[model samples]
Target: MALDSYDLYVVIILVVAVAAYFAKNQFISKPESTGFLSNDSNGGTNSRNILETLQKNNKNALLVYGSQTGTAEDYSNKMSRELSSRFGLKTMVADFADYDWDNFGDIKDDILVFFILATYGEGEPTDNAIEFIEFLDNEADTLSSLRFTVFGLGNSTYEFYNAIGRKVDLKLEEKGAERFAEYGEGDDGKGTLDEDFLSWKDGVFDSLRNNLNFEEKELKYEPSLKIIERDELTTEDKQVSLGEPNKKYINTSVGTDLSKGPFDHTHPYLAPITKIKELFNSKERSCVHVEFDISDSNLKYSTGDHLAVWPQNSNENIEIFLKAFDLNDKKDNVIELKALDSTYHIPFPTPITYEAIIRHHLEISGPVSRQFFLSIAAFAPNEETKTKLTKIANDKSKYAEEITLKKYNIADALLYLSSGEPWTKVPFEFLIENIQHLTPRYYSISSSSMREKSNINITAVVESEIEKDKRIVSGVVTNLLKDIEINKNKSGDKPLVTYDLKGPRSKFENFKLPVHVRRSTFKLPSSSKTPIILVGPGTGVAPLRGFIRERITQLENDVNVGPSLLFYGCRNENEDYLYKDEWKEYSKKLGENFEIVTAFSRADPSKKVYVQHKILENSAKINEFINNGAIIYVCGDAAHMARDVQQAFIKIISNERKIDLEKAADLVRSLKVQNRYQEDVW
Candidate 1:
């Protein structure tokens, strides 16, 4: 058909417009995905299908981690590096939350899977592993072709230690999956987690060598990450992260409402410290009572929930770490980190500075691990220092005396070893790989949600340990809270430690803290009429206080409440007695129904009185309450006090029921199973 001049012009115009639209869409930047790498690029789209990811990436080994505080993830990465570098295996690390479990049976027999699971509170899997655990319980398909091994990280103090790990191992075998190695467990309660892991790893490698005919190569340090120093980007650059947790906080201005929905471990709310006061009167010891305002945000918490506070490293520790690593000069220089291996992932967001990494990302002030010493010895400043480090690492007694007993962190150990010489030869990537990412510290909520619905209260004792040489080892979060207490109260005296209370770019200025609420099963009965016997000594009284307050609030609301008993212990009434006057007020509110048994250990210098002694003193009453369907709640030191309290309860039951000790123990175990006896011990 013949076209006129106007028709021809219209056709050309339409073609030009279409081309312009395509070019604009191509140039626009897309949102970055948070998925990890299965190959050279991130497996964002395919991360949900584990079998496909493994087949597409050509990986023979997969390390899946279910971590709560990043320990399991770190262990998985360590194992992945070792497998890749030492055994020449293609490996990839996967988070339990990222993958689908339906493809487990579809994975080829040649691929090996490693389950690095950490058991959380009360025989539960971690938050990320919850879905996977549910899937394992409900899945009908048998994973007969799967070959796997399990390593669990847990504290032995709990009754269900490494429960998730054991369950996974047993379930996998039940589903016809083959186990290539014996199940391994690490005990943090005994402080032997590092040594246990090393021993277990040796056994696993032996099994691999014998069964799979795998050959081991000479061990060498191979960095999984590539560090790129961005000289052009300064700390002042808007794109750079100077301790900001995520990209959304990169250029966020002060006073902006950054609180969105779905606050959890990954995202935190910048809450303001509404109130602060000292609970102790002693000069040597201090306890702080802090209140955080959650009214402005969508955060909600119950009476016995936990509050997770994300703290930053103090300036003093930051400087020491930077100086020890010879990064003081380049601390402020912006840098970008990229994983060299497809399996590895950068721990934190990149375009960050060394100072920010030290201050906010890596745990620089924790006790140095023997394995870490061995790993970093090759990069020591000189031969003498290397030899010294190697000797200390190899000798258990020497390591205990010099590193553990002295409470030396990485910086402290390095400085003492080299006589203040910087470890310049050590690669930054090695440090990043070896050191663990700083995790949040959880504190028991000490306020009743009924009374103060929008405010969360925390009662924490500032923990400080004095070494043999009189060096003070400070608890990172507690000291940070102390600093906040001092700064807020305008106390002229210097704090035990200093922190940049004005957080990244002053976003956390004016006494603000990065915090989130973690739901806890520890709670009072749904009915106010249910009696509760609380045994808590020292800071263990925190949640107990919440229980008491909840009762008081109920009383004020004209609700009938049952009898309440609190067994509390401390040094003396004049010193470390927490909430002394407040307890009296609470007693007034519930006269004849409330009672408190005090155990002042230091009141009588010759004969110490403790909570267990008081428990025995009220044995008949406790037994009576138990018979009346009262719940027993214990919170305190998990190692000694909790065990002692439990034993005391068993004794009381033995005497009350005229039964044997074993029978009484069974009764207590039944109480636990029935949820009548609860523990919030650490």
Candidate 2:
């Protein structure tokens, strides 16, 4: 029988779809054997019997991930697994940075490309995905045949929220790529990054099934790599297994030459911990105040800025990581790595020991992923164990409620789920390949450059708690800083927690922390002619203090000064209030130009009020400041405090200016786009 043009077109499309599926599975299955490029080494080969038809059809679905931390990469891998196991689709999760774009235009029309892009650092592309971002921005025309979907991760509090995701979506469209589903955006600020992704992804999967006529494939256990034992090693040999590369590398060494500009992603300056104090007297919940000395470095900053601190895992956590990866015996073994591309920078310099890897390279303490569970299934000691691991990995609701929602890290999760099998069998290479590199954390620069140009100050609340599930949790950076403080403050006797006091790569000697300044748009009115209202509670006062100090310095230097008002809040006046005496000097210089209100939530017999209440009381003056071109700024917690303060501002505009709710909202929105209403919330 002769075929018509319409029939021929349909046949071609089906052929292309099948070919794409096979190509995807061929790329994703196994590691070196598959030629698939990924940062993760846990590449498992799916069972041939389960996916024979899909493999034979040669249909490939491309999954690309732009990950900053490992979350996006992990999610991409999960999607790839879902495609292969559930819908009988052959899929590969391509690392966006590593994927070649030259032939994107030639992709099979039936092939579906999934993009998991994460926004990092003021909407900038992640360090590993920078090239991919630049490519899409510059050579978007190359994606004419691509059928794609994108999911972006970002916090709404930032000015450029999910900017990379939005830009990628727009750029791809401009380049002629057809989107299969609506581009998805997940807000980390709203604590719904996971839910948003899951919800959006369901629709995407449904679309793929309808478009391609995909059928479900039963899942089976697949182990990426194997853990084999080497015999004939004694205790002494095991002690030296990590080799000599690690012995010479001290954590503080990375920043030894900060005076000379060797500072980069891996190497950081070990600035001295000049000062440390508790923001509150209460032992239950206390914030740590810290100061870093940069008198010798050329690092300079303004009033509103951020300081990125390079941190190391605590020795206890390091030990836990080594044990979990089954590398404790080879604690001193040396290792090296080569990046496939120039853009693939090692998290840090390698040729180091297991201890260094544990302390610096691996993000060993994060929550476990389904992929992790699936990867470890084959390594289970017995059949029952394998079934249990597989169940945990495959069951989304069970995994979420028992694992992710409970905030369980790998070690605790393994212990709870595995019945204390001791996780001493997981391989070291698997960890280095699967887990993400530790990234630097940013803190608001609480000190003003005008007040102390050569110095930087930071405030953080130490997070240590026993949750409802009875799991102990600690903030990685804050706890590390606290340990440093304790070590420095120790007297003649040995300190309680011995953290190898010197960091890996010798980057931090004398327990000084590594830090670099990151600039912020949340700045003072450049002219100083605009009156300003500042509302901040607790550590939120950090940047506001900078503004106050900057304005004070400007007035002293014969610069024009404007009226300034600050509503600062804390638990008590005598304890948690920061920059107390400095505010007095600041107020004296400005006179009526400066107005300060203090709210002590735990001080009075009437149980404590907050800064939002204080704003309502002084609604008249606030209205006057607003009318006279006042720029309002709020800094602190976005979850509750920032929103409450925002609501208070809306109320002030409505009650004091006697405007309708809608008009008041418009005024706030206008101020927002004008940069007059700024927030530096985390």
Candidate 3:
């Protein structure tokens, strides 16, 4: 059969296209980024090398991090530094959400990659890692050339441990990506996160050395930053930060020009405290409900969201830390910290004073780790102190018994090790390098956004205990809050702890502190008609209060609302029944739609009861709601209450549905997968 000339040409074109497709599969194009980006010390002013096209970069390694709350970020930066310092590899650290992986297939065998990812909230990726997780989940571009390893940070208490890390590893392998080392996992539950990281890192270094013939170098301390003391400038200078969180907050309290900027992690709104009242009627323990006015700031928070309160180190802790480092004399010296390495930057904006850093920006009271102590033991004051420090660091059992069990912070430990002698030999640079930045404490919002959008409420119990020395040990954030509340409610009673709450040279002149709202996945059901069951014991009632308040608001607005059941437990009805009067009012308004199943552990000492026990007493009604498609919520202690509540639900389902324990557990797992079961536990 004779074919037309056009048909023959089409047939030839098809043959050429098929051949080209096979050739392309055999040799995919490499990335366009190849030039090495220089550091600040290297005298080149270029942007981040990782952001530059990857294939064009001469560096053989790239570290990408999916961090929430900065731990993974810290790990990623450390990896970048170590890779460059030891292996002679030009390395760069990048945020997981920062780039598109359209060029993912271009990774070559010689170029290694690393992922330091944190699994947040029940096997879920962090908010920042959401897009990248979806990209990895949906895309199937073959990366036969790629080589990588992963280190996952997770809490072992959760059901799906290190799910993101495991899923990503499997997906990458399926796409033909090879591993350089076995997958690493760090568990916060075992209190071995630091040890796990160190152990995994050592193994990775060995693997890299064996595979790439990488030569190791002596562990020399390289300053990622350079500090400049400004004798000409005072801390009052306009350009100086003075421990203010951001540029807008530099003169917020003093100058009228300083107005509230965008509310974020760096720029917290100095929301004023409006009201404070103690909920518990006991002197040994105190629980207070404090309110904040955010009307002036453009901050918006919904029910179940979290409010982060930026805290200052207690005055006593600050003084002790300064004395340990012998920095008390030069506390007011204004200094600027500049980045010396491209991958490194000061955690906070600088030109801040030593006093400000110590008082408001550093965590001086937190427990010290063994690895951190060993890193600075070489600069100890005397032989005796150095020997003790080294022993504590080297002997794990001794470290746990003597250091960890005592809960001695860096200042406390150093003072004990030095026998109260100030360690003047240790450099100030070493102290700054070792101490971590102060992190804000997050409290669940207790007020309904629907009831009062401009105001925020939180309930916190002051954490104070008398030690053997009769000295009080208090939480860094909660004690400061107690001080503020004392100043507000002056009931002729002095605070259990004191803070230099007038922060940064009295710039925070009033009781006001820095604050920001952290959005949470723990939220009320979108529909008001969705039957919801919540278990919140102690301060866990914080978010559940907001949930109930919202439902009442819905009832007020004439919106159809459904039945809501709350299980709350406390020590005694007369002593710590938090918001007792308000619950009565809510009951009167909602009638049968709302019910409070209470458990007072102290009310009946013979057979102490918990929220889960109360749950058992009302299992039939609870199961009815579950069968009617109710969503379940739990908040409070992850180690105890949350787990107990989960177990209680499994039992109820097994009994009501007449199924086996394992089957009921599977159903509960499915509910979690579908977001019908939610938790906000610490």
Candidate 4:
């Protein structure tokens, strides 16, 4: 129909353009999409099918981890590497959310599976493991030949400690899976998780050798990853990840608006810190009340939700880690990482620099594991260093005295062991494999969502402890927050530690932090008419503040709010009492409906008074509230304070009701069953 040559040429060009667009959309190859900077899978074709994945990789052992805060995943990786290196087993680490469990029972009898699961709050499965738990509970096939082992990571402070892990082990056995080793539980409450894991791992290895006929081979240094220097690339290269969380950030324009929807643990929004203030008056300690602006983002949080703040390692710690590994000179040099095993995945995005990996990826500030010492001993600079590392790794008391008690990180331990000599012989791949990826820190939201729908508030106490050797042990996120407060306010207070507040490419220049909200079951009653009792001490009062604020909002709205009682404790009235003035204002608004009882632990030097003591002192009132159908909420230190408070309540109930201790405990259990008693302890 085209009569003229010019018209025909234009028509052909348009036709080719349309064809190219369709081709790019349907046929052109693209990099596989992954969870934000995650390397959980190797991008294999059979990644979604557990049985097919194992068969395709020819793996004899599979380790599946259900992790909420990366600990379980870290342990799974460690075990996987040890299995491959020490026993010549073909092992693969799998995330619970990555694969389908429908065909899990179809795996061969030769392969052994290990479940490294962590129990989340209130004995619930982790976010990633919920589906897998449901599948095991509701739909599963029996396979008498399948063999497995389970090790649970939990805090003993919770009533249902290791509940998920125990359930998984029991379910597997009920589904006709053979148990190759005894179930193991690691207690974080006692600060003995590492030792417990090591002890259980030794027993598992023994069982493998004795029963499974797996020979224990001499441990050899076999790197699972290959690191290549990307000399052609620079920090300015768009392909490089200079602490950018994911490829999207690296590819997007600097001025692009990225704070959009679907923000979660993997993808976080960079929210600006709109307000910051010091909450404590003590020189020795510092607590900060900080607020974040999320009006421009799609992030929403309830009053009792948690905010996960992703923090970067301090520049000092990053430099020390690089120097220890002899990577200081090439801190900014771009490098590409490749996994040696097809089933193994590199933990972070590359081409990244040593500095970025240390600052944004690795947990460089965490304590050095004894197993790490044993793993890297083969690459020690000298025989003396190797022997010392081996001895410490084997001896519990010596390891605790030298490493645990001193709180020495990898860099500090290396420097001390080598007498200030850098560990130049250690492979960078080994370090990546041994150290865990940095996880986000969670804080209770201290602001009511109804009052401030778009602004999230959190209160935290900056943690800094001096070891016996005068080495300062600082909390990673808290100190980062402290530095942010100092920098933002332009205050005269000297920061205990410094951080690169500007962030990568100056994206976080104006007091911005990467944050995501995690929904929690810890919440107030559905109706404002339900009476409540809040027990919080120190930073534990964070959520209690939110509860009070919610009631205040309801009252302001002329809603019939119920009576509320709060038990607050601190070191002293003039020192570390958090939100002291705010309480007075809240009292004015709520009037007789709200009451606060204070306990100053250090007010009297001879005796240490705490919130539990105050609870006992107000036994009559507490008993009355209980009788009036008041819900009790406890938030604070789970190791001691929360436990003591619960005991005091039990004592009050026993005295008030003229019941035996067992009967009072049973009543408390019944309350918990009815969701009248809740705890948000750490």
Q: Ranking by lDDT, best first?
A: 4, 1, 3, 2
Query: Compared with the true structure, what per-residue lDDT tens digits does model 4 show for residues 213-304?
Result: 89888878787889999999999988788887665667786776687857776678999999999999987899999999999998889999
Pick by TM-score: which candidate is best? Answer: 4
lDDT of 3 by residue, 520-588 (tens): 989988889999998999999999999999999999999989999999999999999989899999999
Against the true structure, candidate 1 has what lDDT?
Answer: 0.86
User: In terms of TM-score, which candidate is stronger, 1 or 4?
Assistant: 4
Ranking by TM-score: 4, 1, 3, 2
Error of 1 at 306 (Å): 0.3
Flag the better candidate by lDDT, 2 or 4. 4
Number of the top-ranking candidate, with lDDT as the measure:
4
* lDDT of the candidates, in the order given: 0.86, 0.69, 0.79, 0.88
* Pairs of residues at least 3 apart in sequence or in different chains that clash in candidate 3: 32-56, 33-53, 33-55, 33-56, 33-57, 34-56, 34-57, 35-56
Tell how far residue 435 is off in model 2, in angstroms: 2.7
Candidate 1, which segments miss by more than 4 Å at Cα?
Answer: 1-46, 251-257, 466-470
Assess every candidate by TM-score. Answer: 0.92, 0.76, 0.89, 0.93
Candidate 2's C-alpha runs over 4 A off are 1-70, 73-113, 119-143, 156-167, 198-258, 262-267, 338-348, 369-371, 385-401, 404-406, 467-471, 491-498, 604-608
**CA shift of 218, model 1, Å:** 1.8
Worst 10 residues of 2 by lDDT: 32-41
For model 2, residues 75-176, the per-residue Cα lDDT tens digits are 775676667667766665556544445446667556788889898755678765776776666764666777888999888866579999999888889888
